[model samples]
Target: MKTTFVSLALFLAVVAQMVASMAVITNPVSSTKGKGGKKLSVVWNDDGKSPKISDWGGVNVFLAVGSQNVQYKLQQLGSNLPVTQTKGSWKVDPSIGANSKSYFIRMEGTKLGSDGNPPMAFSARFELSNMSGQFNSTVQNAANGKEGAAPSSSTTGSSGSSSTSSASSSSTSSTGLSGAASSSKSSSASSSSSTTSGVAPIYLNSALVTVGAIAAGVAAFV
Candidate 1:
């Protein structure tokens, strides 16, 4: 009888653990300041998934910052194809509270024909963005999954280009958290640098958010 009771308790405990693991915590995430007084940076994991940059024809990505309308473009490599503009515009605003940015993407390409010529296919464009911290966090938890015994991170593999993890300082404030939150640019810079080795980091000077891409059949001018 004791053995059976122990077995039942173990089963119940396992079930409780599983439920807790699935619980969603959408509580307001208090932003934190960086160790230094520098601004927060943003990073992108563009290399791992979905229509990777290398898969398409010549591709260029750019970001537009501030009122000066200053823009910087990431150079394109790979196959040579015509630069075609796609429909619609991709825009995002990082200044808004949690997740307030959208993403814009374009693709282009051509294939060699049997006649020793080249055949081209129309380019494709994709744009996606999401707000709502609860929704975004839920999706992220689902997609990222549990690292150890913890719950998942996110569901939507693509959480827009602006979504980034933050680094916090040890110093605490009256809020019982770190000091003032770092700027988004600092977070972006850290993310981009860590993800891309041997590559220069890009700085975002203003609040504006714009990313441009150009391929054989698809091109986005931000």
Candidate 2:
């Protein structure tokens, strides 16, 4: 009798815990400051007592703005985030608002809502600043599931070329001397230092074509 009552109470408490954590954002707890180029650990937690997180499949993380009347989405930090794993790395974009405080992180589950969209959970509103150590917006015409693009990278290259990655590149150029028979003089010096390595053509003094022809004619007469 008493044991049955106690068991029921414990089961009810467990259900309540899971209900509260359906899609709870744990990081950026209303005081987080984010700046451009700064990396952020976007973390959340969820437990499914009945339907379960696995039933939903995955969650999407988005940066959003909330007002008394409406919610506006900014950029999606990640797509298909695991429900139970619930951890993602995001970089604060420089294009966002300056010293703004109306931002929150939105965690959306794959489960459809009454409005034909995934049900969303939001973190407490936080701040974003252009300066470092700051605790880091419009309604889109359409909900875009696309993930944000990563920052572009640039690497210094030879001859004023900029490459994004470390890949080997080489160029060879050969300036051959045409009409060697008509050339009068040849320079012994090689080409100046070039950005790319190449084989240089060697030129000798012009051949005596006329003299050879005369000698051949005399030999024929003899």
Candidate 3:
């Protein structure tokens, strides 16, 4: 019985360690539109073991239309410059020209440092033209070890130029933890989902913790 107790204690300890490790990593999600209007969506793990400051990364998005280039920088909701938080989004302002033929969209992700500053992580670029009306694009961060999928839309343009009508108004809003912007466009939407490799789900970690607690209680009784 003493030998069994020892083995059980060892198992519980191992399980506890595993559970703690599994709760640190997180996946990245993003979405963008650039035809009739411009919008962005970003999502990250808000509640993970890793330092809360480094949970989400900052983002910078650029839209180039004809000879004009517009830049939108998205940081943590309430954090100061170099914003790197769990989630945020952006919407382009002044709107891209309706007569624009070709355009480019660029996205860059920056990981947070120990001091809560942003450091370059990964980047992606897309060239679009002759857009039908609207388009949606999705990308995953490089943390997943696999190249993310490219942006795809339902409408097709001609001569690398989109003929969509002028976009509507633009509005921006942000809470303490998350943010979002609004724009107007019409087209099919697309989405992409990525998972951090070698990381288990949060529920699994909770289950392991519970099992470890039960094991420890039983060991006490023994």
TM agreement with the true structure for every prediction = 0.16, 0.47, 0.23
- Decide which is better by TM-score, 1 or 2: 2
Candidate 2 vs 3: which has more TM-score: 2
Model 1, position 16, has a per-residue lDDT of 34
Residue-level lDDT for 113 in candidate 2: 32
For residues 1-222, could you state the per-residue lDDT of candidate 3 as single tens digits?
A: 011111334335434333332211111111222333344443332223332324335444333211111111212222332434444455534222222222233222345333222222111222322332221110012112122221211110100111122121222121111111121232214312211111111001111121111111110000
Per-candidate local distance difference test: 0.20, 0.36, 0.23
- lDDT (Cα, tens digit) per residue for candidate 1, span 131-160: 211112222231122111111111111111
**Clashes in predicted model 1:** 27
Ten consecutive residues with minimal summed lDDT in candidate 2? Answer: 154-163
Give the better candidate number (1 or 3) by lDDT: 3
Best-matching candidate per TM-score: 2
Model 1, position 153, has a per-residue lDDT of: 15
TM-score of 3: 0.23
